[model samples]
Target: MDGGGDPQVAGPVIAALMERAAGETRVAMSPETAKKLIGLGATVRVESGAGVTASIPDSEYEAAGAVVGDLASTVAGADWIFGVAAPDVALLSGAKPGAKVAAVFDPFRDRARTDAYAAAGYEALAMELMPRITRAQSMDVLSSQSNLAGYKAVLAAANTYGRAFPMMMTAAGTVQAARCFVMGVGVAGLQAIATARRLGAQVSATDVRSATKEQIKSLGAKPIFVEKVAGIEGEGSGGYATEMSDEYKAAQAELVSSHIAKQDIVITTALIPGRPAPRLISDAQIATMKPGSVIYDLAVAAGGNVEGSEPDVIVEKHGVKIIGFSNTPAHLAADASALFARNLFNFVSAFWDKEKGEIVLDEEIGTAIRLTQDGKVVHERLLG
Candidate 1:
């Protein structure tokens, strides 16, 4: 909590502000998470109704040892602020100086906001920047959330396709299984393949990373290698897909186009952080696809993998239906919130200092946190 100023404000004016902001104001925090914070010697100051939208009542937080406060007081002296979305500059400005803030911090999409947080002198941790190393696995919010996004992407695509995923048979004849082509075999892409196969689709997935081929096969899906052109590197730090060269992309397109014509559904999940999503499917390529086929772009918010895709809008061109979705994981809010909270907990555990009531950054953890620390962006590649 903000270390300065009297906890009991001097008079009615400050007390009134605290009263207005305090007591059972709803928050997204669950009881289990609230207890964890209290155990760490942090008090949970919530508005009277913060968690209502998430279905937990004010009484629930109080039962978990939280002291309800008005909005201004709750956030004013907060030692740390936790949220799913990147908080606005106004909220960060209100926080006591040097307070730690943790969130997804979509730096790629909201660089300006992050820059402002840096200017405000608050330590902002971007969970999305967690390293993809073995030691950092527990703290990886991106993979956890993207895993759900991948699962939901397939479900969304399945709903739009005319044919069923699995093979079926009737007295008349045997219905062949739907063919699914998945691009970018990252966490989400791999999940999409598994989900599609579970639904009985004959699934094939592609990625610049050769390592993903074995993973795809292990899930009982075929590994479709788009012709490898020059400059195709595999995976980057954190198991994220790195950018590919234009020549490599053209070759991939040629190979994918040939296979896509026969596919019943296509799910694309390739994304490069801070960059516009690589365009994998051209309008011409989509044109060759049969009518009633479905294409779901998981990177729709990053400008999409398919041509003519509009975020949250399903468009049809040349008989092929392209579905683009923004905020794919928002579809499973409760589950996503839980996983996200766990990631935050694990990350906070690494830095919290109980004795001093502040985070003590160890060498290793300091390096990790420095990936986006003190308002200066620092990554291995960026430093290079």
Candidate 2:
């Protein structure tokens, strides 16, 4: 496991630093991952206080065999730098030349940062682009985070609503259960449905993909779909939903308009990678909802699926409240950090070469996630 007594060679040095992105509370590494990386013969370093926001203290990382130090010391000579978001290239000055940085680079939206990483001669591994394949599921940051985001969205919406989620049989009178309508049955949407049902809401959901109808039903929720409409089979590559046909959109809008007016809560989770979120609920549609209804837009950071939805702000229109978060997963910092750290660890360990004491990615995953290498932006999607 130690690669056989090489006097001059040291195993790879892996490092993690505190996230600097606004509202980002998740740390890229946890003590659990630190211990695992060390077991694989890598020297793990975590910047001091990196895990504070995630409820992990430096002493815990030290207990897991990680060296905790200041930013400069932690990054010095590191071979792999992990983060929740790609750190600014300036913060990586002390790392080895061409060191690998695995994180969400948001390459399509922020070309400047990708270029900076390329110019600095670092390998940028955009985890968000992890290919949607069977073997890569455990390493998928999006699915893991979105699963949590879906749960959080429902919880937040339920909190904001004036009525209780579950019906009550009290002494005075019976309280009817709240109605929850989920738009876009992706990972987040599915979780939102499950959560709402658990909270005792009468749940119904809709998605562009007709396949999700069964999934919604499996979760004990009603599936509202536009039948006999073109573009209803919205499955796209990587298991994401593609844009719907104009006719399908009009039909779905008509269906939703009638359904939403009787609902108490709506959760919208539709997002196309590298594209603005598809508009699902217009202002006019929102205006038709009951006065006290609540809508949670999980895609608010991606320009929103609901009209007038602003990240981190609750805007009221026509007596309805619209709310969203710029970073929904961050609101559940502890669990989000643990899962995210495991994702990075899983990715590296899967490709680890025990004899060489390093990770060696195969073509399939490497091609999908490697955004920069050898002083140029190399990902095919970014090349054009």
Candidate 3:
């Protein structure tokens, strides 16, 4: 199965492969994505049937100039490996000694697994750490995936709610639009606002960062906030919010409780990278919410914003429904895979040299996501 490759010499050719992890429905690369990667003058190998769950066939991959093979042959001597999720160490048994892997590895959540990847002599680029910067925008997997989640969250709420999102003029009587309140004005929250608005819902949003108020308003949604909070400034580096202090949390909760009680749907997207998701919705606030209200907590996997949310489950509490759909992007696997693959292709083509057939890891964003190098955990944040 060896493809006769030398690590230093073959760094230019990358294998956008797949994993056999059960229930993982997304593939890192599609047929069209393979074609784009090949245009960069790199030999691309796609494992046969890798994209099957995504509705892409082996013939399509081959037509796009990719070598179709089993996992062993596909990863054979490949210096670089790209995937939707990090492959299990067992899956990498046939990989080269120092193969570089780029994927959504959830580094902070699985510190031990990340350490194992480093100990196994693999250099990892955790796509979740892709910095929010102009240069890295085209390659930001988190935004691409989270954009899907935000839109879908609204749809999930709309579908589950007994009432309609838009006002209906029935012959019997006029029905008012559903009220939606989204907390967290990041990519997901903004998308949720846009989707809910499009569905004709009366949407309002809140964020710790006052800067996001303009953005929320731009989307025709009201920005709700506690004007004065002791600790939460809603400002941070790399275009994401930092953690809020206890004092700010207490004050914000008091302000939000009253507003939440009147809403029909509440979608919480507040999250701080490398930290447990903040509790934005309390048990008491949830109990007071209108009966039949829907609460979709996007951060449930990272602890949760709602009091009783569980990862990937839908449960009712206090006459209200809490929908916690884990890996939201994966629910829309085909389209999600397509967008994710395109982002992966952009990231690789950025550093790949066509004529010279060389790989350059000079992108500043690359350093941020690089979790291991030369058989050691290298990223400064991960070191802690």
Candidate 4:
């Protein structure tokens, strides 16, 4: 337990972690996340006053079932460790070899650090790398977080746009509903479409996956489908969009530009995990959009799906507003945390062994967990 920061204030992952510890397990938690853990059933250990940042008093953990202790001794005998972010190397040095460590390691971005974890003999489970399979839905942290991002993107776009989202009848005049275009029909994109539609906006969406067209239509939104290219199905394992050929991209881009110019608000959620987001809207396309239109790029962290997107900043070019929000999910921290925490709990439940005081990786469930195992990085697509 690093006790780096408070978990209650950080996200619901802490609450879920606490709840999971309730079932016949003697789990230990850092003071930051321990107060909630104690209430669930496990005995917690805190270092003096670890939950002060989150306004959780040290005595609260004790009342819930925790003991205050030194940080070094807390890690010395712990069989398992859990966290939202990866632990620092200094913290890792304190843990015994072969400890089952689980966290959002960001293995794709932090390859070197993950390799170091492997070399040190720690079984590091990267939550971000969980496969997008039916069985793994409960453990899909990325989807859980992105669902919030999708909802938020619509709100942000509505706020930025000068017009109202819904059509309104007033004494002054009749206001038409705003037209919103969503790129990519993934989880985030679909949610954006639904949110926009709920706000009474006339929503339309596009995706390389032909299968998503019906889903979009079912949500009472129009689905923009360009002509399918030969030899291109636009599908990938784990429910991700595959990279398109240059010719396919050009064709799709041309078709999208005409549709984009008519949209009052555009929310782009196109992203390929561990790769740069495909560039869907070019500078010229942005120029063609209505002067007061707003474009919210949800993929801004991965180089953006729209042109002129700058992470955490709103840029105006030729009277069109481009919003590039890096951590859109953080805006809804409480809900995001809860969903993420549940994801972590579901993932760890498969391995938790209360009586033996150890973790046994189930081959089926652990298939996704063992991205890096046996001194090697082993994701099916990530591995060469």
Give me the candidate number with maximum TM-score.
2
Residue 243 lDDT in candidate 2: 79
Q: So what's the TM-score on candidate 3? A: 0.95
The top-ranked prediction according to lDDT is 2
Q: Write the per-residue lDDT of candidate 4 for residues 1-384, one digit (tens) a residue.
A: 323233322111121122121111112233334554443434334454444333445576667555555556445544456655656545644554566566667667667877777677777777777867787888887888788889999999999899899999999999999999999988899899999999999999988887887899999999887775732354565688888778778889888988999999999998887788899999999999889999999999888988779988889987999996777876665566556656765665555556643346777667676656666666564575
Estimated TM-score for each candidate? 0.86, 0.97, 0.95, 0.82
**Whole-model alpha-carbon lDDT for candidate 2:** 0.93
Worst 10 residues of 2 by lDDT: 1-10
Query: What is the per-residue lDDT of model 2 for residues 1-384, given as tens digits with 9 covering 90 to 100?
Result: 222123432688899999999989999999999999999888888999999999999999999999899999888888899999899999998788889999999988899999999999999999999999999999999999999999999999999999999999999999999999999898999999999999999999998888898999999999998887855454677899887778888999999999999999999999999898899999999999999999999999999989999999999999999999999999999999999999999999999999877889999999999999999999999887
lDDT of each: 0.73, 0.93, 0.85, 0.70
Quantify how close model 2 is to the true structure by its C-alpha RMSD in Å.
2.2
Ranking by TM-score: 2, 3, 1, 4
Q: Sorted by lDDT, highest first, which candidate order results?
A: 2, 3, 1, 4
Give the Å error, residue 175, model 1: 3.1
The predicted structure with the larger TM-score, 2 or 4, is 2
Two-way TM-score contest, 1 vs 2, winner = 2
Provide the lDDT at 272 for model 2: 92
Q: What is the lDDT of residue 344 in candidate 4?
A: 62
Off by over 4 Å in 2: 1-9, 232-234
